[model samples]
Target: MGTVEDYLGGLRPEQAHALRRVVELARGLAPDAEEGTSYGMPALLVGGRPLIGVTAAARHLSLFPFSPAVVAAVAPDLEGFSLSKGTIRFTPEAPLPDAVVEQVVRLRRAELGA
Candidate 1:
């Protein structure tokens, strides 16, 4: 039953700071996206569909771009970062770049027809 703010508040200072930036970037890209929880993670929903989700892990912060196609599109640019089928992992020390974040959001928005 926790909110996004509550989730962010529970993270360590560094983790929280990095996640806050991601959240800010998401909101900037999709102003109308609703803030809520998805699969126990803080997520943004556009047109009632999950747009993006972020998580604070022990070693790094995770960005769930919510699209495999988006991940594949950004894969070349993610050479130095750790990535999975759906999650892009980065450290608090070296947070995700703004451009990368924007690209992810833009792709997801397009996929959602937003």
Candidate 2:
């Protein structure tokens, strides 16, 4: 994708809306991050490194901090949400909490040394 907007545009309204909120929140935390992609997924790039990525899957929305450690550190707060080694999965109807997202973004930034 040329930019995150292109990725978000292809999503369902609620999914796109949720991902937008994610990108907005991440932007507030890392002003240096730019709209970009990592491994073909829409992402926020910090120092040219993918800090965080938000996208829609077939059945749920996903957030990738691109670090398994970040996902592990935040797993306790996620509770009912699905978690992989480096991803958090949720639905737009039950979007991730802003506070949790804030932590994820900060941790990813720290991990990236951004």
Candidate 3:
């Protein structure tokens, strides 16, 4: 299976940079989280569960928090970003803020009892 770095390497430089920032945020929030592929995208695993997955699409990069509740928890802070039940879409030029990323990770971590 391809590794997270391999997945990031395949993306355009700007996309990779943006995704890397998200990965960094996750890592900072959950230092014990493991990096791997989950649901065919680069993911961080904590307490044996996937915390978040990131995908690079043609028009934007997507962050999958893997829980609709997590999205809803951060809904107010997600102004101007495209959000769905499981994903938040953003451009490389306007990636989600580190504060937003931390909020998502914290919410997921709490939900998982980690």
Candidate 4:
């Protein structure tokens, strides 16, 4: 998709809804955030730094926090989940916790001192 809205529009209702939740959570936590694409996935930026991203994959949809520390802090609750340095892999069937996402955004913002 050329844009984040186009990407969201292309998914099934449930998947789109999950992606929308991530977007809403990111925006709510960082009102001045900008929306764009990073590495072909939709991303939200806080103070010009990448804060979060949502991407569609063959097996699952992913919402990446873009912070290794944030992912590490929440690793306990993320057992059995696949993750990389800045990305967490989850299916659209499992919606992301808004609270967790907000915490991540808050932590990242604090790290950025913005």
Say which candidate scores most in TM-score.
Answer: 2
Off by over 4 Å in 2: none
lDDT, candidates in the order shown: 0.90, 0.92, 0.91, 0.78
Model 3 lDDT per residue over 1-114, tens place: 476778899989999999999998889989999888778777899877899999988999999999999999998998999999999999999999999999999999998888
- Clashing residue pairs for model 3: none
**For model 4, what is the alpha-carbon lDDT of residue 100?**
73
Per-residue alpha-carbon lDDT of model 2 for 49-99, expressed as tens digits? 999988798899999999999999999999999999999999989999999
Put down candidate 1 lDDT per residue, 49-85, tens digits, no spaces. 9999999888889999888899989989888899999
lDDT: which is higher, 2 or 3?
2
Judged by TM-score relative to the true structure, which candidate is superior, 1 or 2? 2
TM-score against native, each model: 0.95, 0.96, 0.95, 0.86
Quality of model 3 by C-alpha lDDT: 0.91
lDDT of 2: 0.92
Off by over 4 Å in 3: none
Q: Which of 1 and 3 is the better model by lDDT?
A: 3
- Top lDDT prediction, candidate number: 2
